[model samples]
Target: MIRTIVGLIIVLALSVVVISSVPDYSLPSGLQGVGQDYTERGVNDTGSVNLVTAVVVAYRGLDTLGEVVVLFSASTAVVLVLTLVPMGANPTPSSSIVAFTSGVLPGSIVLFGIYIITHGHLSPGGGFPGGAVVASAFLLVMLGSNKIPGKSKLLASIESLAGVTFGLLGFWGMMMFGQFLNNMVLPAGSPGKLFSAGIIPLISLVIGAKVASELSGVFSSYRKAGGDE
Candidate 1:
């Protein structure tokens, strides 16, 4: 009861503080400072037409790295939980329609995911979404097929390698250019082209690989842990 009271007090206090602070926080009318700079020089500076990608993979690449680390930690936690959880569930395959679609769609889904990852610098998709899409393919298989998929060891190895590759590329940039994950390591080709944007695509590839492997492994583990097979 004391803890509950304390929690309520804390929540109320926070709410009061936020309400008091609301007047002091004004919404920006438009882009200013860094935003302005990124808007103006982002394309020429990073050779990436997609300003967001330029910022994520070049200007503020460390932030993206931190996000990856967070994801890795989460995946690690899930794996630890996997060990604690019993894997005694046997999943029966789904109906014929689902089985057929699983066989049919996975290939296309995987291909589309790769396309999204590779073309991230030029388009609306990136590593996270693309990887999730790929992982969904694995999920489809798990839901529809009879055979157990996602070799945990292989997935883990791929995840580790992808993570290592991401760091190594950053280090490579640091060694030669003194900036980590510098996209200027290679020629930032003409914008809006497939070969443009230098290291951005490479970074996306690794990020996609890491995310896909982690999610696929988690899905497989869940399926084996008594979820829908």
Candidate 2:
């Protein structure tokens, strides 16, 4: 315990030291430049209404790749935990009130999540937030509907497919554009159209599907283990 505590302290100290040593810049000025440049590029080059999506999926696709890695890591960690500690079956029947509420909630969440992901190029919501919302819906279902057990294998398969697709798409981009995640090959559809922004919508859908599946798997395992009690 002492060694563990010391290690944690050292890690925390290092993090603080690193953060403190970082150079500070005029954040507002930087943001203004970013926004102006993004807007100009969005109109002139991509013609996409959603500058943020253009940035995330095209201009800075590499960052999105890193974000996917983080999600994959989280899913892997959850799977490891579930495998090491077997969860038991559900202990109690879900209350009627909880069931009714949960039933209504998931539909609304699904709708909202879809909207968020689909309109990501036009609004603030994007793949990650949309995915998390879908995951929350799955969590609610797991909590309130014990009768409908989630399929772990199916969820795992979906997660794997999404991850694989993302990687393959990145590789394809590299082959076409000489950069691993460049969106240059994608048809820059008319800016505000639903199909615009090359691979942004597709990537968002993949991320959402993966996150939802992995989260459902995690929740299902916990529910089975009787952890909900």
Candidate 3:
């Protein structure tokens, strides 16, 4: 109760200070912010029409790569959990639901996911969301059929390859331009084209494949733990 009261008091004090300073607030002028600079030169620098994609995949490529590592770690943890604790048998689904999920939804989801990842430089969606969608295709298969389709070993191999490819590309860029993940190694063609962004698409594809394979492995582990055939 004392801690709650103190928290409320602090909130009230901060609110009062903000209210007092509201009238004095004025927008700064003269120098354009980095955001404006990114907008102005994003296409020219990264050859990606989507400024957000350029910022994420080019300007902050290292950070994006780190995020992929974090995701891979999380998926590994899930696999470890499955190894430790066996899951229960899954409840059977309706025939119609199974048919739809197995026959129709998986293909559509896979296609859309690939499209999203490949066209990320020109569109709003990127590798992360696209990867999740691709994983959902595996999930649909799991739910529709009583058995997991792909072998976990294959998925693990692909995941490892993708991670290695990403790291190798970064090193290659560093070797060529003296800067890690530098886009200067590859020619950045005209913006708004499919092949405009040099390494962005390649990186996105790797990330997508890595993520999809990792998540699929996680799902397969869970399925095996559940005693599903």
Candidate 4:
């Protein structure tokens, strides 16, 4: 009862904060400054119908790169810490229902994640969410499988290569266009298509792969630390 009351208080407090902030968020009378520029030219500039993708992968690419680097660093730190510690107690065995669901669900979830990454330039979802979805599928597999899952070495290799490729692509854009992650380095195709948006889709896919690999490695390390074989 105390725990429930505390939870309700926390929720109510957050709700009050959010509701209080709502009045401060009046709709803009008109798009202005960078907002105006992006709305006016994002499609023509990056060939991504999804202006959010254009901003994330083209205009503000460096921010995304920094975020990925932070994620990688944090995962690496956790992995190293785990390596130094003694192995923890073995994990409890999964129930039959969990094992069955893990077996049946991961493959489809992975495919859907790939779809989300590939279509990011045309849709709402992108590399970050796609990668998280894939990682969650791996997490489910680990939680439900009889054995601790994920290949550590393979995940590391993939993660390293994807990180390198991401940097190399940024350099490539710089070489050609005097800017990092320049979307115009390659020809931008027709919008709302599978193979458009120059390097945005490619970078998005790379980000997804790197993020998935990094998270999978972290998950594997955690499970291994629990003395799972």
Task: Judging by lDDT against the true structure, name the best candidate.
Answer: 4
- Per-residue alpha-carbon lDDT of model 3 for 1-229, expressed as tens digits? 9999999999999999989989877777754889789988888898988778788878999998899989889998988887798556664554786756587789899999999999999998777788889999988888787643445578889999999999998998999988889876788998888987879888889989998999888878877677543
Model 1, residue 185: C-alpha shift (Å): 0.9
Q: Using Cα atoms with residue i matched to residue i, what is each candidate's TM-score against the true structure?
A: 0.85, 0.78, 0.82, 0.87
Model 1 per-residue lDDT tens digits across residues 1-229: 9999999999999999989888777889989998999999989987788788788878888999999999989878887798688775566768999988988999999999999899888988878789999999988877786655544578989999999999999999999889888788989999999998889989989989999998988777776666643
**lDDT scores of the candidates, listed in order:** 0.86, 0.77, 0.84, 0.89
Kindly report which residue pairs in candidate 3 clash with one another: none
After the best TM-score superposition of candidate 4, give how far the Cα of residue 84 lies from its true spot, in angstroms: 2.0
Model 4, residue 107: displacement in angstroms?
Answer: 0.7
Checking candidate 1 for backbone clashes, the offending pairs are none
Model 1 poorest 10 in a row by lDDT: 145-154
Candidate 1 regions with alpha-carbon error over 4 angstroms: 1-27
lDDT-superior candidate, 2 or 4: 4
lDDT of 3 at 124: 84
